[model samples]
Target: MNLLRPFSLLLAGLSLAASVSASAAERIPVVASFSILGDIVANVGGERIAVTTLVGPDEDAHVFQPAPDDIKAVSRAKLVVVNGLGFEGWMERLAQSANYRGAIVTASAGIKARERADDDHDEHGHEGHDHHHGKDDPHAWQDPQNVIVYARNVAAALARLDPAGADAYRKNGEAYVAKVQALDSWAAQQFAQIPEAKRRVITSHDAFEYFGARYKVRFLAAQGVSTDSEPSAREMAGLIRQIKAEKIKALFFENMANPKLLQQIAREAGVTAGGKLYADALSKAGGPAPDYLSLMRYNVGQLLEKIRLN
Candidate 1:
């Protein structure tokens, strides 16, 4: 009945316009392939981006099966980030299927990957599923220097997606790098404290090659990089023999992975069971290793703690 209320109508129009503008201004939606990518994205993107991870911390990304939801997420992402270098084998197909048009950034773009253990042919004379970090060890983040490259790539990608927030991403990435550098220093310092001979470790898997290379730790594994591959009984016997011969101080288990094999090895080797280490994924929020930084810190700390005690 109040058809003449022009002021009220004008006020409603302005309110609706403001709401629409706010909704449109919401930060760009970003999706990272895995936890490491997600962590870098969160650090660089900060609160201006909505970051989602496909394989969360502590979950194995190598054998990860991309769910339908992940495909949809990638299809809708503003900028999709992956470690690339063949890390996510399913990623290429998913991206192709989704027809995602956004920039797909390879965080390891500048990284020089490590050589595959068996650079030869598979049993079938074809390519083997075994890898050296997706051909170059997408786990390059294990090396702090490589992490610098990752942060830079992430910042650059975010800047491309949302130019207005580029400065924030760069600033945050630099600050986060400082923190990572500190962690690197602390990890090195911890290893420095242990005697060179005692620095040897036997892990459930080969996830720590970069870390070992960086920190002077000797990590021997019965199996290859991924725990998915089962080590033969002969391989286990050989490992057990080597462990006894070397007198390796402790045997370690990955938290996110099954510890049964490591436990069996420990029992057979007659050594103390070292504490859990975070390798593939980060621990859940309530657990010790929740984030990338904390995960690194906790793993090294626990390794040191157990080695020192034994």
Candidate 2:
């Protein structure tokens, strides 16, 4: 070959090597919108992906202010998973700001929603409102039945990203869904022991619409689904009035909200502040409720025991 041709081939080889080096140096960074989503991604992604959470455990994502490091994580992530139900309003802003090009997987898509309480009894505009009041509740996984859908959604998304681990992700999802079904059966069995009249519960936030709807329990709350939205004074007053009228036995606090509100509500309503609950996020690795399975068991089991005692 000619000398110039040999030199040109050498330069091309060097350029290719540099590109491969840069690409190989990058890890498959994954970002989750919040702690619960992060936990789900971790289960499905396993060790193949490096996962980061914009909002950590017990943080209200509705009001979360993501940090610089959090932004960096998202910017570098190859995939971003979110529980979309207008839950993470800031996600779009952050993703755009970071200029991330990752695939977005919304775990809540295709889930059957519960009607919002606001629309439940609003005679003012009752005719044609959808599940926002009639059918669309964002907290589907609270019902283990809905978590099966979440698992399938998560598995499909992860498989699309990394086809190599598709088998593992699928198996993990199925196994997890089976566990969720078991938990659902267990929760129903535990709650069944309670008298129908005593199935009423009071929580700090309205996070249990799905749980209540699925298990046929009544979850009266002092606040709405998100702690970020402050309850109107009239709303709070009305809740307190209803609690007293109903003789609601227990008043549990969400791990995410300001406990002061629930504490005040409990004191005003003349009910002892009840057990701690994991509504918004999984408890840290070794606290009261650890993983998803343990977390659900602890929450439902505690409620069962307390409702009986009260």
Candidate 3:
């Protein structure tokens, strides 16, 4: 009865598909080193960017091995963003392999870097030998205030690349910065409710020094800064003694780290392991800590709930 209707529908579908392709083509291609940084870039760039994250959710970037697809993504990107501060030791090699000529933006560019110290050393005073990234603790993103700087940096970089979208980028960056500031204020208030003596925590690695400094909470780790570093038996023994003597009860495993080590520590110290903290990466899309803002809130909430037990 309506033989022409099917042909008309097919033509309309093709037009819609072409429109979508054009829209995607108009967006700038951006490559982020990890999921958390990719989320920040997405917030800052908004609809103007198509972001490709090399390190997916809950994946370790410290020992990440880029595949051929990653190289292609980098090569095709108009811009690439990294956490910097030695967090991406493999980034340089990957870029070389990709022959990426685009600008690489360091989100933590202007922030004052935290230098690795005794926090990276175990109880027996053994330091991490993998200081290939130097003495800087690459986990600056642990601090929400630092992320404000990250938003600003990403905005500036994107503005430089896509000058036409400068206003949009700035507005987006400002909005993101406001959200981060609010988060920082809330976190400060939350920590204020806890006594100074109960603010101490134990984790698998020294990835929270920035967070510790920001919130004034001390973090003791079983291993050093990098996850690749193994703790000596003497070091673990010393840590166990300290945990027992100090009665520290807030122990957590990072999302990207091996939980076995922290689990063993908890068992030895006779303390129940708390919920996992998002340190180096975000959780999956459906998980609690899917983005940077959510990640911080989840971590702070978890820490508060558990540290109260100390």
Candidate 4:
């Protein structure tokens, strides 16, 4: 009960508090190239990481131009997440300019990319890039199986950055994988309801080839892999002719693509524009698709409803 004993105890407590504060301040800062990957990082990283999404929800990353703030964000981050496979045409330049020395994790690391099979190719076509560094299709996230790879990459990256949060990230990654599995199962059941031949639909761009390959839905578009590429008159007319010949049930626009192009196509093709699809980007919060799971569900549901044979 000496007064000196109490003073010494209080000093030790203060030192411990300071140590805890310093550790907490070291929280890893992460920058994701786009919204979909941002959500994936958030789900896996949880509270241990601070995430900044360069391209926001319902925004197109195909034609995204990084601002000064984006460079600053990348420069300050300990981890920068990109879809890689040449998805972000501007990301390499931006990262180099910012001198981002931290770990640049390619979320689509292990997935095998699908090659573009279209004969009429445009400049933005996904021809040369593969899963990690090739010009293969960059829309791998459209298939949920590939997203499992993405979640694992994110968890492993977070673990590497902050070992203390490794267990938490692993648990989150496992849970997200389960959710994706369930979603994939649900999608299969829904697709089974429709006849295979009637699964074709037209959208604004060629962003859904991976989705089509996985889900058995055939997506036709006037533009190539990159939405920034312009639709040629011959391509549009050819798509319209194909739509008329196939009697394609529905035409749709993506959240990122201009609806006017699809509207004109629909008019010429004698089809109505279906509900907007979440292709390159997700819908805003409180909208049809606010997260990865919701985005897949919404797209699948819309396809089932619109493309079903009457």
> Model 3, range 48-102, lDDT digits (tens) per residue?
9999999999998888899999999999999999999988989889999999888
Residue 292 shift from truth in candidate 3, angstroms: 0.6
Highest lDDT: which candidate? Answer: 3
Clashing pairs in 4: 128-135, 129-134, 129-135, 129-136, 130-134, 130-135, 130-136
Indicate the worst ten consecutive residues by lDDT in candidate 3.
Answer: 119-128
Q: Write the per-residue lDDT of candidate 2 for residues 59-163, one digit (tens) a residue.
A: 777578878888888888888988877677788889888998888888888886776766432221222222222234567668778767777898898888889
Q: 1-310 in candidate 1: lDDT tens per residue?
A: 7877998999999999998778656968889988866887798888888888999877888788878888888887898898876677788788888888878899989888865543321221222345535555556777888888899889998888788988999999999899889989888887887787677788887778788789877677755766677776767777788778877766888876788898898899888778888887778788887788888888888778766643
1 versus 4: better TM-score goes to: 4
Task: State the local distance difference test value for candidate 2.
Answer: 0.76
Ten contiguous residues minimizing lDDT sum, candidate 4? 124-133
What lDDT does each candidate get?
0.78, 0.76, 0.91, 0.84
lDDT of 4 by residue, 1-310 (tens): 6889989999999999998888667668899999999999999988788899999998988778889999999999999999987888788899898998888899999888887645434322323222232458789999999999999999999999888889999999999999999999999889888888989888887788888888788787766777766666776777777778888876788998888888898888787888889987877889998999999998888888888752
Ranking by lDDT: 3, 4, 1, 2
Model 3, residue 162: distance off in Å is 0.6
Report the C-alpha displacement of residue 74, candidate 4, in angstroms: 0.6
Show model 1 residue runs off by greater than 4 Å.
1-25, 117-135
Output the worst ten-in-a-row residue range by lDDT, candidate 1. 118-127
Candidate 4: residue 232 lDDT (0-100): 64
lDDT of 3: 0.91
